[model samples]
Target: MFTSAAMFFNGAEEAVEFQCPVQETGLTATIEELMSLLQEGNSNSNSGSPNSGSEGSNGRGVYSLDERKRRRMTSNRESARRSRWRKKRHLEDLTEEANRLKMENRELKNRLGLVAQKCYVTWRENERLESESLALWARLSDLNQVLVAMQTMRSQY
Candidate 1:
């Protein structure tokens, strides 16, 4: 446990040393190393304060409870806004699709009506032709009966 604490101290000293005459990558690496050391520091009790890990020392890169909470809140708000915008865009796309489908449905209905009208006219023409055919067959049957009677009278004479 004391070894961990000592490591944390050395890591923090290196972070502060790198801050002056700052090399960007060196400072970032040292700070990241320090945070990892502190997180590995399992103290007996977490006092829920920023300085709790370092025995109340004001260390570099330590986040206070309020700052952490504020950051989390801002992050959550940004996520929520992005989600709402995505939903709104999806709904708009659905609405446009529905409108297109409705227009297509109307066009199909009009085509069906035209097909029905054509079918009715064709049926009427077929009925007229059938009636004319029946009338012609009846006249031919009467003529055949008259010819048979005339031949019988001539044979009797």
Candidate 2:
């Protein structure tokens, strides 16, 4: 029974060796090499032999389809997470830009309002000055007419 248990543990260790270990950065160099060998073997011989090259495979590679799928899923998840973060950042930037533009627009409008008010006040002052000038001219003309009349009366005498 002790020998049987030891044999079982050895089998488990061997099974672990037969499969590829998942790596964070895509596939490991060893797995990539094995996958290439497997592809080559498949292309060369479709003999459908039960045993070809390695212990579990037919002299090809130790590349497992499930392992490839799992790695792809992990990579895709990471890519999606990055994409979401980028989109969120972009939205935040746009929002900040919009707020800045709105503030600028409001400031410009205020400045325009102030300028318009100053222009109206200036126009009113100009109208008042024009009226005052016209009145002064009329008074001067009346005084000149009175002096002319007196001169003519003196000449007649």
Candidate 3:
């Protein structure tokens, strides 16, 4: 009865072996060499029997499709997290740029107002100088007429 049980266990082990394979990797490598082997095996099976390579194993070597799928899911989740972080950072940069532009616009407007005030002052000064010049010219003309009248009187004497 024990012999029969042992045979049954052996048969179950063989059946499980055909279904899946086990492989190992180092903690340092992020891209697993194990997954690459599984991919290659899948491709080779579709084409023909695989060539005997350096990664030697018994016929029908061990691998787990469910583990591969799980690894892919984890990688996808990490990629999505990174993408979300990048988008958030991009939005923050845009907001900062908009605030900077608004501040610059306000400063420019203030400078323009100052320039307008200075121009108004300059115009007023110019008008005052023009009026003073016209009055001086009129006074000079009256003095010239008086001098001519004096000269005429002296000629008569």
Best by TM-score: 2
lDDT of each: 0.64, 0.64, 0.60
Candidate 1, which ten residues in sequence have the lowest lDDT sum?
Answer: 1-10
lDDT of 1 at 118: 94
Cα RMSD (Å) between model 3 and the true structure?
A: 12.7
lDDT of 3 by residue, 23-120 (tens): 33343233334445555555443333223222234454333454446777999999999999999999999999999999999999999999999999
What does candidate 2's lDDT look like per residue over 1-157, in tens digits? 0110111112112322133444645445555666557655544443333232233525534334554567789999999999999999999999999999999999999999999999999999999999999999999999999999999999999
lDDT of 3 at 48: 31
Model 2, stretches more than 4 Å misplaced? 1-62
What clash pairs does model 2 have?
52-58, 52-59, 53-58, 53-59
Residue 123: error of model 2 in Å?
1.0
Model 1 lDDT tens row, 27-110:
666756674566455321233453433324455444546656788899999999999999999999999999999999999999
Ranking according to TM-score, highest score first = 2, 1, 3
Q: What does the lDDT read for residue 134 in candidate 2? A: 97
Give TM-scores for every candidate, taking all chains together and pairing residue i with residue i: 0.56, 0.57, 0.54
